[model samples]
Target chain A: MNQDWTVIDGLQYSAWSREIFEQMHEGGLTCVHVTIAYHENTRETLTRIGEWNQRFESMPELIRPVYEPSDIALAKAEGRIGIIFGAQNCSPIEDEIRLVEVMRRLGLMIMQLTYNNQSLLACGCYEDEDSGLTRFGKQVIKEMNRVGMVIDMSHSAERSTLEAIDYSERPVIVSHANPSHFHPALRNKSNKVIDAIAANEGILGFSLYPFHLKNGPKCTLDDFCDMVVWTAERMGIDRIGLGSDLCQSQPTTVLEWMRNGRWSKTMDYGEGSSSNSGWPDSLSWFGDNRDFPGIADALSKRGFSDGELSQIMGGNWVSLLNRAATPASPFLQHP
Target chain B: MNQDWTVIDGLQYSAWSREIFEQMHEGGLTCVHVTIAYHENTRETLTRIGEWNQRFESMPELIRPVYEPSDIALAKAEGRIGIIFGAQNCSPIEDEIRLVEVMRRLGLMIMQLTYNNQSLLACGCYEDEDSGLTRFGKQVIKEMNRVGMVIDMSHSAERSTLEAIDYSERPVIVSHANPSHFHPALRNKSNKVIDAIAANEGILGFSLYPFHLKNGPKCTLDDFCDMVVWTAERMGIDRIGLGSDLCQSQPTTVLEWMRNGRWSKTMDYGEGSSSNSGWPDSLSWFGDNRDFPGIADALSKRGFSDGELSQIMGGNWVSLLNRAATPASPFLQHP
Candidate 1:
């Protein structure tokens, strides 16, 4: 593994702690886009941010907040993990387009238009019918573009994702999802979606979450690397990076909260059936943040050059952030 | 009556309708600060704003939104009542300091730190302990001042109200509360609070709500005018205006929602007792927006000069808004 490589994970929703921060350091993770909100509203999202604020205050040596692309370099220089805030759902903004700017100012860098259901903005992958973008959704996309919040369509329906990519002036993102050509999972993106993303110069972060993988918990390092290579060949290496979708140290209850939120009255198994409700076992090679070096080694063995490996690891993500996360308006830059 | 005088109601929470809007026209109202949130969170508050948006669209001829003091002048020129959005509680902003600016940008011109109990920002009158201002409250105040959102302490505790007046760079307001000397209701402000407001160049908008009146619904026009005269002598006429806490066509359920919200499992009658757990009867001389002319007539009968009448009726509120509601920072103006 190249020590100089800027290793960035495009998405993670870990039960964050000092141990995990130390693990990130061990993995030489420069920056990690962390989910601060799943179904949390503005106030609840603020509480989550407050919790992260406390973590940053307590563990300043291990981690710092990444407000802009340059912060990743600063974090790498400081030997600390830079955390970029993201929302898995648009719940944090609720129905207000103005909150896109507010959340951006408060350091929310990425937001998915929908999770796994029909949202105010767009239809999710799990919905029966795909409503590409509501009137509010179009307004929100414009606002998100103006404020430089990355529009993530990982959990959104295919039509919505395509519409978003087409509608957004800035490049969109699938912060954490693999290719459906490899896995055939509902959460994974189709070739068309990936090509659209590539055409729009958007990034597609391959998900390592068992449910989004080809062989679930038993997925081999070679197979995952092969999938990455296939995606790179299809979407171009510059438009790809790692988004492990790691849920390190989180309990089953937290998983339930992620899948169900307050929207469901009864159980919603999500990607799992009743018999497989709990989180799947971690893959042998990439169990946690500490396993990133192993992934780099696997990619190297799979014939990726040092330059290509560097881009796959985090360099691509850094470039994407530089392009997609800078505020469009000068006035928004100050606040 | 001086028809040219800009007649502004400092606050109103009527069950707004086209009928009520027509009543406002009849009252010669230039502008009205309407409460859009009591206990609604950020999302729910946005829904309320959405409802008002629909109203604005439907009744463009009757009313227009007042984003700034100048908007009021435009509304008056257009022969329309300017609806200035306000929140009776800090629930809309929740715990985020940044939302103060966001809400302001969305046309929320005023926010009370507390409704009638302890909030995240300050202590309400109903609370046993009056924590003047929480750490978040101070930050919110600064943000509100910077974004040009008026700080209203109409339902706050004595210490909190005084502290807010002292802490805010811009003039604070008690948008709809009578002086405790005139009416000993817990909802009314104390002489200390009123004097502090006057000292800080803040305005006190006398409430027409029966609970804040001398003899409830039986309170005569003369008695109300005398109380106004007395308050003017003490606090200066420039610092007084009408808030007319009129509940026009709202049901008892709406009143209950206002008093109890979701905070209380058991009923909290607020200003009313258990026996009187509903809106107080409307005052004879000032029942609704259409009755403003009678109150002005009563004030005139009480030997108030035409200049004093104009100031008391609405001129003072317009001046107070000009002083308090202009954004402190230039960057916030565009957003």
Candidate 2:
């Protein structure tokens, strides 16, 4: 990996601690979009934000909050990692549509309309049918655009993902998902969905989550880099970045909550068989915050130029964020 | 009108006051299912219940809490109207399935799965397509059945309603909706839905809301009684009772909240024209809680025998409540 290049993981929900924050700084990660909510409601989300606030106060030299795209550059200059808050589900806003602005004001920069089940906003990937964006969902997308929150469709259904890209005035993103053509996990995006996002000038963050990789935990870096190159050919190198959907050091119960939440009384072994409900073993080459170099080295061996590698490393994500994290977009202002 | 009839209104969400409580006693309404939530989350719902607790304490002579079906008889014996708390939407439980039992413990006896939009439990009548019960919805139905909380599908879509009836081990209730065959309103049920509820031995509350009547606000007592006769032909007299979704003395903004509820920034002229967005004029035959005698007289004049008229007025509801309001059912015990 080129040490001069800026790196941003589009999404991560690692078990944050002083050690992890130190590792993030050591790995030269300039920015990371950290998930703050999966199934949390507004009050629970507020509590989580309060916890993050304490972390920021205690470790100012290691991490700082990123409210705007320029803050990522500031973090890189100051030798600290920028922490951008996002939600994997819109449950943080509950049923109130106006809370989109409220969430944005609280620095929630990206929000997925649904997680692993049907939400009031849009259909999730696990739903039996993809009814696409709902009336409430359309309004939410507009408000999110107005308030500069990126519309993330990583866990949304295919029809909903396509519909969101069509409905959103600004570019929508798959903050942490891989191509279904590479690995047919339910969470992976179909080619149609990927093409829609890419054509709309959105970003695709190639996931390193085992289930989303071509051969689960045993996937080789060669296969992974090949998949990325194939995707980049269709989606453009300037649109691809690393998301690494890493869930390091989390308990099996956390996975259960991620899949089931309070929505189900019975177990929902999402993306895994019933007997293999725990988290999959990590790929040998990439396991934690300090593995960006392994991916960069592999991409270089695939005959990518340094400029192209820089674009995939973090330059593309920073450019997309610059365009997306504006409080008032021309499309929304003039539409 | 039979004064001795044990009248139990299946649902009502009026602006409660001393005046309304006085009218309930004046009209000999032995029990009433008062809606406690439209879009309130659990904590908000708890606050509403706390307010009701204060009302019960302050107005002990006029009203009493009814946690069990036998409490209705107890209230009648004490000459006070029994107040049975119900939720117009399942928002009170939010996304937590175990909160079903928590709500039941809080004396929430009846709960509609959806109000006027898609909820986690089921789709509302206003949605474009009814995809029926979700994965969470099936578990919610089972939990509601286990805890003896009556599943009310008054504002739910047809397919979702029918699926709830099919999925529930206990009989479900259409707590406040009429037959579409009578009025052709979108919120009203079709013959298929009515028959399903009837076949399952569930209760159907004939709504006195203007839009549900055959001719809106101008509907005559004769027209209303005739519609009742028509509905009784399909669903036996034993299954029908009054559920006047009366919003007496409430301001237009309250109606707006009921319809929109922060779900949309735009106005939703639910079941009425844009010009008639406010509360409709009360039916001439049934203006307030003191007008139960007028409906009973109209039913008598429509040629129902005294025994049949007694069953229509409230006897059927009380009997249904007796069967429906237990802590646990045998089906759940065995299942």
Candidate 3:
């Protein structure tokens, strides 16, 4: 098993910017799955996504886009942060099915079926009745498989999550969710759902959303590791991984934008207010505490082995990435 | 034409208490389309709805549930407000399609298709794009038509609006939109779209979200009148009406919940610290302003004929209520 000692982030919402790239370099991150959007967007907004790709391409060799699983080795050889751009919401592709490939070419490697709510493709995690995938949502899952983007079901509801996992030829990833066996309400995945994914050999990246933690925002890095360990016990070691959803920079400036609740759009940047009442003093999400090795050290303290350590740190993601990689078939380009 | 005002408030959302009821009695409001989810409670929400029937049924002269057009005249003779008990969002139906009739039989006469963004039935007015109606939404619309509830598309998006309007064998409603001819954007409908409704013999409502006005927060009552006049000229006076969108006692406390960049279930009372710099405001919302009569006066002053004024003020809605009056036939009841 002479694999690269790559630290792959299965999922994160960090700013896909130079500052974050710099932080990834400093944080010992060899790869990161940066979420884009799986929400609604106008055509003009979708075009700007092309502009987003240009920015990813602009980063120094310290970071390069990873499409095929083979790109990981090449990036590791250079000791660069492999930025695997993904969409938190799928609104960028809008209703067009072909843009899936256009996005793949531009390096969108993974996509959640929905964000905090419903999209044309699928139902979200919080929708009351747990609507399975809509007719279009099922199409999206198949397209996700055909295009080889890892299907991330982190924010999708139980029925939708199960349907997506069942529809996907390759196993999907619950890229960032907390164990529902521990807590209930807005941010936890159901146990039945976890068991189903475990059977499918899917990965579950435990989230750091304060609401997902039993201690809420007061949970320390130690509590975060405990959650990881607890989830692993329930969902088998190989089916679990670390997805430290840390952003390199916490814009004290942008918290109000979140209050607008749209998360991405700059509708009222200066006019909104924020209430960070749930933040734990021990936690730091902005650039200062984005240390990858620091998180690894916490997992090690929780009795994680070099194998489990390497798996969560990056290997599992590499394996999943390999499984989801759609070989560039020149013969099937158009027909 | 001696239909002395039945005073059917097309829609109203405010915390219900003995005080609010007294205000309704004071306002000479014979009936109101009161929102169950936005305000009111389970203890007496339906009890209050049933109370309207018992009070009116007992009097056989005053307040009653206006399930048919003929109920208005009879209610006015008795002197009670017709309570069209309903929900602002179908979220309470959660995801069940059968609940449509159970709630309808329980006095849930009108339902806004989607509140502000996405629901199973259609996209909200606030969504970036309307994914049109989902299969469940189509089923819901058909069931609504069958069950005899008026399909209010006031808060729905452009695409969802058109699709729902077309799918519904019964004419639907733009229950609370100002015309783009007044102030164009997401909240206002285009002449073409309004014309489509008129062609279907459906109704268009004038809302008071200040952001949809010419000067937004600076808009005056006269500006509101201008919108009504503009819609009348385009959609015909007979088809135009007032959705007033009045939140009489609550002071528009739910605006924050709507700014979730979409309609949200989580309630955030008070002016939300939101990122909707671009969202519509309430120059017209008057949240707590009971001087809604002033808007009526403005319409009267603007030379809306006493006949035309009466029609726009509430007659058109009465006609829609009559048309949408859950048909009594089994075909109408279970279409």
- Report the lDDT of model 3 for residue A88: 70
Which stretches of candidate 3 lie above 4 Å from their native place? Answer: A1-4, A38-53, A56-58, A248-290, A327-335, B1-335
Please write out the lDDT profile of model 1 over residues B133-187, one tens digit for every residue.
9999999998788778999998999999989998999999999999889989989
Best-first order by DockQ: 1, 2, 3
Q: Which ten residues in a row have the lowest lDDT in candidate 1 chain B?
A: B326-335
For candidate 3, give the lDDT.
0.65
* Model number with the top DockQ: 1
lDDT of 3 at A101: 51
Q: Which whole-number lDDT from 0 to 100 does residue A188 have in model 2? A: 94
- Which lDDT tens digits does candidate 1 get at residues A93-127? 88777677667756788999999999999999999
Better of 1 and 3 by lDDT: 1
Candidate 2: regions farther than 4 A off:
A329-335, B1-335
Alpha carbon lDDT of residue A151, candidate 2?
94
- Candidates ranked by lDDT, best first? 1, 2, 3
**TM-scores, each model vs. reference:** 0.61, 0.51, 0.46
Ranking by TM-score, best first?
1, 2, 3
